[model samples]
Target: MSVLVEVCIDSIESLPIAEKAGAGRIELCSSLATGGLTASAGYMKQAARISGIPVYGIIRPREGDFLYNSDDVEIMLADIHTAKQAGLNGVVIGALKADGRIDETVVADMVKAASGMGMTFHRAIDHCSAPFDALEFLMSHGVERVLTSGLAKRADEGIGTLKEMVAFTQGRLSIMPGAGVSPDNAKRIIEQTGVTEIHLSGKTVRNSLMSYRNEKATMGSGDSDFAITVTNPETIAQTIAAIRA
Candidate 1:
């Protein structure tokens, strides 16, 4: 069986690189520099129009919090409701309580909302009070996968526990380790965790050095563009090669 390399695409431009580099799946979002936010239906449709592979939506209303307010929850519901219609293959979401626990009630509603589509628990699982508890809950909730750094800043730091989680999960759930997986260590993580899927950006930042004179309209306080990061095609090929090796 092949280990799926899930590439996170930040723009229409990056999608072709991901498709060409032998990635099995993609998580499409806007402004991944801001830890990712939901891509619009128009963007989602455009992506779906281009590639035949599955594109999972990052169903976050905004950056900064894994927990959502009532209105934000409604927004997530709406996003999920329309995502498949926009031709997306799945929806990614996570919401937590202030007490560092899975917001069970909210998550349950989300699960129901995303019933027909593929569902993944986003890295919000990283902030959960108890890892196994939250994991089992997601499994029971029928979440297809959990995209995480194993509750750590990077997968290397969480490798030990990620192994434990993989053992606990057996084959019931997909434990996808993301954030910092690269060509060099991608093989090591798989050898260690024996997981079937890994997520990657294989990306490098590309921003204009030229400053804009219109300081009043600059989102970055005079920066020219919204700051773009492109997927490294060589990194993608190298990561898959390592996984196969």
Candidate 2:
């Protein structure tokens, strides 16, 4: 079977582009500048309405560390409910303890909240001390898939660990290699790691259309100043073609 390509999109505008590019699925979220936060209910609804493929809503309340507080858990649970109500096919979630282990309590609650929807544990597993243990934990908790870079900052650098993760899982759950995935490397990554699924942003920098430019002023604290990154359909198509080839 060909590898499944999933694009991480921050806006609903990317939905049609991704679908047109033959993306098998999409991970929907907001605040991509902060590494993606939970998307709003309005966005989720619009995404589901417009997307032809499955839309998995990301349930992250914020960026930075995956270790979430009680309030964060509450917000994530609420977001999961929102995703389900908005008719999303699944939800991507992750929570880690301060000690770099899966926060079983909070994760279980989120899983319960996502009872009938497809559930994927996000890259928070990369923050865990033991990838094997984390994989087992997620499997035991009924997670359908895991989006990870094999505990490394980038999937290409973590091919060894990713292969190990795929071998260890033994098909109990999917091991999806993500982060820095590109058309140039998708095939090699899939072959090396034996991962059936891959995730990428498939984005390119787009300059703002405003004619009046303010060189001194900035929008958000992050890199949201002038150029915004948007999904490139051609890039997504190339990635899919590479993986299929």
Candidate 3:
């Protein structure tokens, strides 16, 4: 089967580049430089309007930890509701217990709440106390897929575990690898893991030259120059080609 390239995008402005490059789908989020956060409804709608490919909204409220409070969970639920109403194809989300166990109750609720919408258990699966158990739990909960890095720092480092997880999943669930997954490494990972779906942010970050007239600038670690953009056609094409190769 051909590789499923899901480009992680921050805004609608990045659409043309992704589409022109032949992407099959998109993972919508903002501030990817900080892991990822939920994008605004207006942004989601605009993206859905322009991107012909299936767009999946990410449900992360913030970066840092996976354990979310009740309010955070409520916020995620509302975002999911809004995302579905916006005609988006699906959502990527994950929640974990303080002890690193799968929050079955929350996960089940989320699965039920997203009954009609496609739901993917996000990278939190990688943080589970038990990967195999979490996989079984996710399958039983009606999750469409689980994005993971085999509980390793990077996909390359976790390739073996990913392959094992794929075998454990059989045909029941989609075990997708993300984080440091590249054209140079995708083929080997896929070949070993036998996973059909792949996710990536096939773009590079360059400092925006446009100076901000509205906001004041401060000297800190966070700045546009320090920021990175995602729209590297060459890298994306190379990665896609490598996967196809």
For candidate 1, the per-residue lDDT at 184 reads 87
Residue 112 displacement (Å), model 1 = 0.9
TM-score of each: 0.93, 0.95, 0.93
Global lDDT of each candidate: 0.87, 0.89, 0.82
Clashing pairs in 3: 205-229
lDDT of 1: 0.87
Off by over 4 Å in 2: 211-215, 222-226
Count of residue pairs whose backbone atoms collide, per candidate: 0, 0, 1
Estimate the TM-score for candidate 2: 0.95
Comparing 1 and 2 on TM-score, the stronger one: 2
Candidate maximizing lDDT: 2
Candidate 2 local lDDT, residue 150: 79
By lDDT rank, best first, the candidates go 2, 1, 3
> What range of 10 consecutive residues in model 2 has the weakest lDDT sum?
219-228
Highest TM-score against the true fold, candidate: 2
Clashes of 2: 0
Give the range where candidate 3 is weakest over 10 consecutive residues by summed lDDT.
212-221
Estimate, for each residue in 117-154, the C-alpha lDDT of model 3 and write its tens digit: 88888888888887788889988877878888888988
